[model samples]
Target: MSNIGVVSSCSCIHPLVHLLRPSIQKKGLHTAARLAAKDYYEVLVLGGGTGGITMSARMKRKVGAGNVAVVEPSETHYYQPIWTLVGAGAKKLATSARPTARVIPRGVEWIKSRVQELNPDKSCVYLENDKKISYKYLIIALGISLHYEKIKGLPEGFNHPHIGSNYSVHTVEKTWRALQDFKEGNAVFTFPNTPVKCAGAPQKIMYLTEAYLRKTGKRSTANIIFNTALGGIFGVQKYAEALLEIIKARDINVNYKRNLVEVRADIQEAVFENLDKPGVTEVYKYDMLHVTPPMGPPAVLLNSPVSDAAGWVDVDKETLQHKKYHNVFGIGDCTNLPTSKTAAAIAAQSGVLDKTISLVMKNKLPTKKYDGYTSCPLVTGYSRVILAEFDYNAQPLETFPIDQSKERLTMYYMKADMMPFLYWNGLLKGYWGGPGPIRKLLHLGLK
Candidate 1:
């Protein structure tokens, strides 16, 4: 490995040149001699999102600070769970993001570069800047990538007045604006065929738009329609039952197995294809359209050997450890965990991975398990939410010892007021894992 410095002939001095000159002068132009003597960390985390941040902080506390390094490109950390609220006119998009430096664990080296290649066979990762990072253990927490381009005419027309998506912060506010400006005809919301981070987010915005329209006295002329690729309002039966009740009461038309294929923003038309029967297209003219575009793992991660066939980190469901490579672990939306990908799910997974990774590094089998706990604060109206919490078995795991499927004002307040603060101060800071302890305590250890 050569440590030679390359310089361009430009007159302007580069920032790195100024910084490195002091070290070069101290070492008498032989600084490259000390390159191989540096000690790398024991663990390397590839992202700084919810899972990566939580896992790194927990792991750093357990295995000392100098033993871990996080490779993340973004300087800002986003609380993506709040993007839904932002799109619903309940919160600002700015509130959903924070400086990554403030949230990452103390003493953890933050490499501000993307991982270009994963040489997992050699326990090293190549950076886009041509730097190689070696680690004794690796954790892949690179979150899902929103693929707006996957849908025809999507990226181009997404920011148009009547068309928007809640998946990205840049376009989420547009969704709320479109809803505010909607006066008549059909208000169409489409759920893509691909897996999304928050599966309920698509329809959540629809409910929010419905409430917004009603509030603005436009509900009479606007026909609220939910075109979902899935068969039901929710995967879990309990929550689905409640959602169905709301849909029927609101008189919202629900279309199943209908996926958005393209958006004709010029004419305010959205093209949909029936998933069950390909080539069967349905065009719906809309006054406003909220789209949840296709999402998947980051392209770099998908092309790496660490990814499974579905382009997600291939990990054991219970352990959160890689199937073949015991030293590698994964969490969050990027992992093939067979559960709904939500910040709540990532919080639960953080606890499981924090313990499992520590045991793996000690040459022991992981005893910790993740029961696939995930929660979605289903906001049906401005002051109502059904806090749907469940496990891998789809069994309801209510935290407050009450029926969480019913819409309640308290749940809505919790989602709006407390959850955001909890996410930033508690979860991202590696303080809150999940509602498991509270659930256990509330149920008197019966659950």
Candidate 2:
């Protein structure tokens, strides 16, 4: 019998609705024969987020749908890129959400539960309900963890009159409400000291708010402030130089080496600490505040065998395969990929990972590599964007003939309109393979 052939549920009739009931088994030992016999697959994916969805869909096509399974708990999936527009009231919050059932690839097995524990030694995973499933190959794409409580007074600060954050659907709409009601005083936006999914997201809203205020005639009355822990505006110097010019031209205050430590929503004040001078702290009064909270790899990865000291999956950065486990691969924010986390990075990683896994399945040495291609669409205003596409070395790998660091309407339309379609149709369907092909056609540069 082929190990990678069709798999069937023993008692469950509905493939999507029926789930493995809670049970405890570990290291492929001390498990009931019935449970162990019924729960096995050729390939197992550990997330339903961007990287997981794309890779699972691609894997299903390669190994046959019945041989693959994905473990994800959520029913609703959010197109997070559009949240910046949703928070600006330019796009409705409803546009960003979709039923997870609809987008999960046509035939892959969907286990609707959180992964409680990852066991690579036994090639099995423990679900939150305690049920266990074993697999020959594993893909880890569980993404990041958002820590709002780490900042003092956050759960309290959230939804306060002038406070807002675009990180969650619940609070995103509140940002537009706060922006619309503003009359005067300081409008503060903050970027945290830790690594976040989209490093540019913290300031994308700042620029949009500045534009909104100018359009609504409140720009003069309100002062725009961007407080960031980073020493500079952006990671890539070419883009950083362009962004500094933008903040200066718009008169938006840029405070480098400063971080938001607390949000005093009761008194409508925001507290900050100077990262350079450890003890120096300051509090600023605000009429409006947009916060980007600190983020990390999933909470489950803490101290796990698969994780690095920083709690990220320990993977070969170029191949995306786990450093110690040849059968395991990782993508997106959860992996120590040494690239800024973004959907664009996930898109590129998914393509590279999918191909490598297919080669490994065929009993071959995986030779594919991911070059750390990630893009950041810096939306400067309601109608303009600076699309920054680059590689591992901080070099501009422009997709178009024009300079990408400069703001343009065409790029804005791509971010505002084109990307969502590509994400929904091309990426989820396993047809989109990042922008490498497009870059080649436009620049005549091939490797």
Estimate candidate 1's alpha-carbon lDDT, on a 0 to 1 scale: 0.77
Model 2 TM-score is 0.91
lDDT of 1 by residue, 311-345 (tens): 88999999999998878888888888898888888
Off by over 4 Å in 2: 1-38
lDDT of 2 by residue, 1-447 (tens): 001000100000111101222212111211111222348889888877887878887887788877878777776777888888877888998887777777677667777777788888898888865788999999998888777878899877775788888887668888989999999989999999898877888899999999998998988998999999999899898999999999999999989999999989988999999999998998999999998887777877888788999999999878898999889989887888888888888877777888788788788877888998888888899999888877888787676777889999977888877777777766656666677766676677763
lDDT for every model?
A: 0.77, 0.78
Every model's TM-score: 0.90, 0.91
Q: What would you estimate as the lDDT of candidate 2?
A: 0.78
Positional deviation of residue 60's Cα in model 2 after best superposition, in angstroms: 0.6
How high is the lDDT of residue 398 in model 1?
A: 77
